[model samples]
Target: MQTINCPRLIERVMANTLESIMISDRRGRIIKVNNAFTRITGYSESEALGQTPAMLRSERHPPSFYAAMRAEIDHRGSWSGEVWNRRKTGEIYLQWLSINALEDEKGYVSHYVAISHDLSELRAREAEVEFLAFNDPLTRLGNRQLLMNRLDQALASCREKGEVLGLMVLDVGRLRPINDHFGMRAGDEVICTQAERLHLLAEASDTLVRLQGDTFALLRHSQASVADMTHLAERIIKDLSRGITLQDKSLLMRPSLGIALFPQDAMNKENLIQAAESAQMQAKSQGRKMFRFFDHGQHSEQQRQLIIEHDLGELIIARKHTGLELYYQPKMCLVSQTVCGAEALLRWQHPSLGWISPGEFIPVAEQTHLCVRLDRWVIKQALQQIKSWQQQGVDVPSIAVNLSAHQLDQEDFASWLASEVAHEGLNPSVIQLEITEGAMIRNGEAAVALLEQLQGQGFSISLDDFGTGYSSLSYLDSLPLNELKIDRSFLQRIDRDERSLKLLRAIAGLALSLDLQVVVEGVETDRQVALLSQFGHIKVQGFYFYRPLPAAEFRELLDLQ
Candidate 1:
């Protein structure tokens, strides 16, 4: 091994090491400093040379702190601990400093050596970890853990002051569908935008928190009365009602708020949150842009819906179609008095709950991607049933399956649907896709393009519940559509109001002039059928002809036809 020069090796080590090193003479003035000292303190050796350590003293430590450190160094000849020091630029920083006294042969202190390690980076990392524990990384809002902590304190204060505390949970209804239609980045933008809006609406004393995906909470301790909470919820709804433009595409976020009061809803944190969440579900079930307070009577219904949603998720995960069945309702062509097509409707028979209404469970499914999955399942089932009917020698003309807006928004939905039909060895013309006008309006131009793609594949597209939505006449001309199914509401008033009758006739005439097929739904009376027959070549679907039946029964009906 080569011999190492001690002095040269010490100089190289001092120059390269990250820890700042300083040497002071017995007179207590800095005599030498390593390169790290200048780098860490923004001071060159020349500037530091004749300066005492007092030059780096900060106001954070009192005179006694330094005095004790000096005493320890004097008695024990060494001291090591954290210190607050000022850099050459006058910025206060933290450093772990270790000092030792160097003595001569005479046993008297001659020089002092000090090593400093910057603690700024370490301290920053610690703070960041703590922050992430309590805040949502995406929105930078308080998370559930922080919310529960704040709630406990707020409730304690409320109890002492005899005041009420309101906890409001707001659910962004269309967020998941937006994520599915747009991208996850777009979904993140929506969430951050909503969080900023909520921050602006929150009172100074109110604590805003992000619970999880598309759900946020606000704890209001001041002005927490029913009237105050109502006003806040209205403001939130109004503020969020405006469209958020993402990538030049305008998207609307519908908010549903649920409010639960302390002592009234529940005294504990968990129960209070549960009550607020239950109320939020109820608000969503009622409609979009709605708010509701916790009601004991509706709790059971909300629980049932929760169970339904959970069970639906399980079924989708397991790919089990146990209780799910597609019922066929025949559509009659008045001109031929024969079934022209059959609308496939979904029905669920839960093992214990028996038959659950679509109205009850569909909204629950719509809250998540379950609705999209449900729509896909319906499409597959309809196609398979059509193939089965054909194999059984039943002459079913076409099968109509309802599509949700979420399904239409999917980037590859049209291709996937066409592939499904082709997989069944059936022509696309045998399948009819029914979409609501609201779905078209919500999806904008994308929906129209998807419909055109499906139509180009030889599939028929029908605008369902026509009069219930925007009903833009422009859509009638622009959209690639084969049929229009008028909502039943229009026919309910037809027998009593002559204007309603004239309006129906005008709509039917306009559709006929455009060479589009027209179907009137929910015809329950003979008088209504007689009135509808005058419309000429229109199809009718409702209880008047036949109720929705199982596949076997529907096959029998097709056989008789």
Candidate 2:
């Protein structure tokens, strides 16, 4: 400290610093520059000497900008701010520049010292942050934030012009299963492919956004008519329906679209998005590649569903099963002309809503974790009821319980069912598992494997609601099915429609040839029953014999039989 070289230390510090340092005389001619200045401006110290800072000026700043900077420096004796500067290579870059004036003993400016830090990296980082905030990382499409901003602007413009705005929310079906089966990379490929296809369908005025996983929104900035919206929806569905090839394997995508109109369906951005989402839910429920328009009636139904979902969650959290009941609908074998088995149907009686049908609440449950809990509850109650009936000498041969797709997704479902049956001291064959084709299709090979595991454990597996799904015949031989329950739609006109009757006969015969038991559902009239009776060795289940009844009533009926 005693022998510190002050001037040498200052020069070393300035040379070592990363910031570009420059010095100019009172006449504004370059006098000195540090190494960083040469690195930043691509100029040698010899070439820069005697030159004014105007050599580094960029066209980005107007003449007024330079005048203001000069005024600030003259008034304050210093200036510091961001400046656009040009390099010797003619490349423009941003820099944070600070200049300080040095005065002599006479109190007049004699020299100026300037320090500059390149802002290219900082500016790039800021730009990247801004882009990510408004775009989906995977698809590089506008995200929900950008969508909201554009939607607000569009809505304001539409209100002023007295024009309608159409908002379409689209969902890609079965994407979750794809992600579960194949890896997430496959899922990303599918999402990118769909986004490209949707972008291709978009017009220049339209705004396409990726709201979240497997969901996209399209804002119809032009031609917001009902017919135009419908046509766009149709084109989207058809285009997405074509199989996307991933690693030489073709993956099919079914897109469902929901259209909601501004001013008619919703007046605000949030409400409009919700309306479109609700309509999309409806479209998915109706079928794949389908589109639905928003209606007040559907909105009311959606509100009720929300209430039901909330109440169901409360019941689940409280572990309250008193409101949940299982009704038994008897399945009679035509060959024996007696009650052979009964189906356990779930019913809920909400304290506030009075009675909620399965048709109304089941779909809602399927969308949440409530479905798995509900399925387990149904199985446990059915098993306990069967033991109670047997103890009372009610000779109910077998009981069928419907399983949700969520239940099939559980890895331990088969083992859990086996343990439950064994705990009740009942043969596994006494319990039949009724599964919808849609459930099997959703779970893919996993469902088939689960069914085979259950069958191996002596549990009977019946394919429920057949002929209404996509691949019934293709699955007949592969699925470990003991019975096929023909859907009621096939029998709605069986009494008068000869083609339906013949088709029903063909299905029954097909099941018979495969040595599988056949069950015909929805035989409402004696004529339908009489026509179905012609098929040998089949079971009939519908209101024609008996509607679903409470357990006590069902036990009494079994006792009478």
Candidate 3:
């Protein structure tokens, strides 16, 4: 066997090993270093040799830390922990280091050997993770966690200073609609631009945060009163109402703002956020581009609505197999006083809550993608009923089902509707879709194209609740509408209001000119019917003819007719 030189063996081991190896003489001067030591410290072996390891010390540790490390090494012969060191480039980095003392045969310390692994990347990654936990990925604004922390700190300050704090929750009301229209990239740009605007609006003492998608929170301390909060909310609303240009297209962000004052509206962070959100909801309900201060009554109503919304989500999921029914309201031709078509309206047959009104739950459904499912379910049920009615020898001409903006804009709704209709072996002409003016316009060009597609497939489309929304006359020509239903509001005053009469005549004449049939809704009285019937061949539907009925009851009405 060949005998190995001990010093050469030690040098080979140090040179081959990956760990940074440094050797110091008994007097604490660096005697040697391996290639890894030079690589990690950005120092050449020639530069590092003869220099003490203290030259690489980052000065981050307290004297006590070094003293404890020394004490451990003296007592236990080795010390292992994290340490901060500086590279030759003057950049500081963390290192996991293990140090051992080497002794001669006399048992006195002769040299110190330290093995270190560079930990800069790991430390940076840890710091980045911490930052991400409190920041929004899209806007780099403080996130929900940071929002809560800031609110907690503000509440504590309010307590100490005996001053009021204003917490405002802002919802970009147009975000979803804009996303549907322009795409998510533009939506993200809008959110980022809004964040910058909000950041500018915030004072140095205020904390502005993006809590979640299209939702932001601002905490303002040292508010003089609730009025101050209101003013701030109004300022936010005004600033956000201005249009933002994205991809060279102008987009408006109508912000609905809610303000809750701490120590008055809420005493804690969660409750404060809840109250501000409640107020923001109230603002949205009142109108878009507005602000509302938290009122106890509104808050309570919001809480009740939240419960209904939660239940509504569950109800929608189980609607196909369980708690859902269609109620038909007969639409009668005014001249014959005979039913021409029936409107299919949704009713939630809640097991515990009994009959929940569509007016209450439909809005809740519209807020989520569940509205698309609900719309599809309504069509499927309506078409299935039509087929059943025809089989039983009941002549149901057409069934009018209301359409929502969300459902209409769904990726492939037109094709899906056609597929569903064909699957039931039902004639497309036997189904009429009623869309409100607001929903129609909200969907814009996409809606016009879908309406034309449905019309091309022999499906009738009706512009329902016509006069309530701000629709341009140019849109009427663009859309493939088969009918225009006069809003019930106009009919309510048609008997007395000459202006209402003239407006009705003009709308009916316009529909006729466009070759679209005219329908009048909410004909609850004989006088209203008589007034509405005077308009040539217009049709009528209301409580006066028949309240909405169950499928069986409606079938009975068909039989009686």
Candidate 4:
């Protein structure tokens, strides 16, 4: 086939195309230029005709950059990538450029064709995105992502040089209140000013980053020891606690710092930050303007508590799937010596964590708002067991479920309990609620009203761990309580301590005077049980008679009764 050369067709296409197109002779002198070339380079075709492509050199790139680019194009016959070039007005801009050598007959290079797309706007947008991703826009400080990257690098350097890397997490405790009182704009100003102050305190090798709202992180590279970390944290706390002025008003800011060390607290980036956060929590707990070093034991405990909290959250959602459990310890009448009732004790049998005591997990649950759900589950389980026992013709009188302060503090707790009990189809008289004296004391009037409402609904209310808290007799007289349970601590020392017996007797007398049934807990020894039997018409509960039993075992005990 015979080929036809269409120079005019090529010229027409090049002139109308968006991409800048230029043809240069073998000596690299521009031979022709299209409209797009003029548009992108800001030079007319007439002005560019005799000029070399070197006229567009941005000078941003070093000599080696051009040399390597030229070598690649010559050897490969085509090259394409990002390049910086100068416009006719001497302004530099980025471009995606492609160049190909045009060959003459016998494969001799005759001319070069170059095409380029303006990338200045695209590059600018990319830079903005990258900046936003790794920086806090409000404070212009490195964000958490950037902090993680720097932490990873810091850890690697520490390992290589046998140095310690210290990480400090600072929490601005007053920022929330400041934001609430002064507005977000003022809060932002405080943050930016704090960042500037923190940046000024940082060493040349140290990195200051913003982790999240009112939280900032610092990476101290090549630290000497715990002393170095503590010194740095102290300096930061002192400097930051001096306060900043926002809107012409001086406001004091409290700084709580957590410091974690390399190869000591953690060896990786994530754990290092976590350790620092743990220490920061400890610092905050100890009061503001203070710092705490990451203790291995404390971090482990924090992590374990975190795991328990997480597991409890999951268990709350999956209670029906066997995440939570309840064990019952029988409460016996002193005169009859048979099972009168039992307390439904919350138990957690984590699939992997095994059995966790209520003492270990209950506080965590209460703190995380999981207590209400957990308490509901306990009530449901207790009601189910009660129904099962009733169907089996067992004479179990009542099953008491403990309520946390968190539960009683809820505004609708009484109604919620009544609804749950009714939903389970269990008679309210057969179910009892046990509340600690502390809970009643903390909740005060709300607790009393709820307890009275529940009592009015035919649910027996017992004040558990009665004498442990400093609840006055006046307060106890006003509570709509059916029973007062003597705390285990008094019973633990009942056999040996005369004072304990006097205290127990006084408490028993108080319960009797108030027309409340008295129940003594922790009746472990036979001697103590005998001593407790003297109280007459009292109830006893503890390990001597029965340890807490699983639902199945408790059911068997009910059959035996």
Best by TM-score: 4
| lDDT string, candidate 2, 395-468, tens digits | 76889999999899899998898899999999998899999998998899999999999999999999999988
Enumerate clash totals for all models, in the order shown: 0, 0, 0, 0
lDDT of each: 0.91, 0.90, 0.86, 0.86
lDDT of 4 by residue, 1-561 (tens): 968679877878997999999899999999999898998999998899888999999889999988888999889999999998999899999899999998999898899999999998888899989999999888888898898788788778889989888889998779888899899988887888788888998987888899889899988878648877777788889888986887788888888998888888887888888888999999998888899988788777877898998878876877553756788999988899888888999877888788888999988988898888888778878888788778878777788999988888788887887887787677899998999988887888988999888899999999898767785777568889998888888887877898888878887877888889888888888888878877768899998889999988988887886
The number of the candidate with the highest lDDT is: 1
List model 1 lDDT by residue over 1-561, tens digit each.
999999999999999999999999998999999999999999899999999988888899998999999999999999999999999889999999999999999999999999999999999999989999999999999999999999989989988888899999997768878888888998998999999999999988889999999999999975599999999999998887779997788877789999999888899999999999989988888887989999977987767877898898888778897899999999999879999999999999999889998888887778877889899999898888889888878777888988888888799898898889889999998989999988888898999898988899899999999888778877779999999999999989998999999999999999989999999999999999999999999999999999999998988888887
TM-score of 2: 0.62
TM-score of each: 0.58, 0.62, 0.57, 0.74
lDDT at 145, model 3: 93
For candidate 4, the C-alpha RMSD (Å) to the true structure equals 6.3
Residue 551 CA displacement from its true place in model 4, Å: 3.5
Model 1: how far residue 517 lies from native, Å: 33
Lowest lDDT 10-residue stretch of candidate 2: 467-476
Once fitted onto the true fold, the runs of candidate 3 whose alpha carbons sit more than 4 angstroms away are: 1-6, 57-76, 152-163, 171-196, 221-224, 234-256, 263-275, 278-561
> What TM-score does candidate 4 reach?
0.74
Give the better candidate number (2 or 4) by lDDT: 2
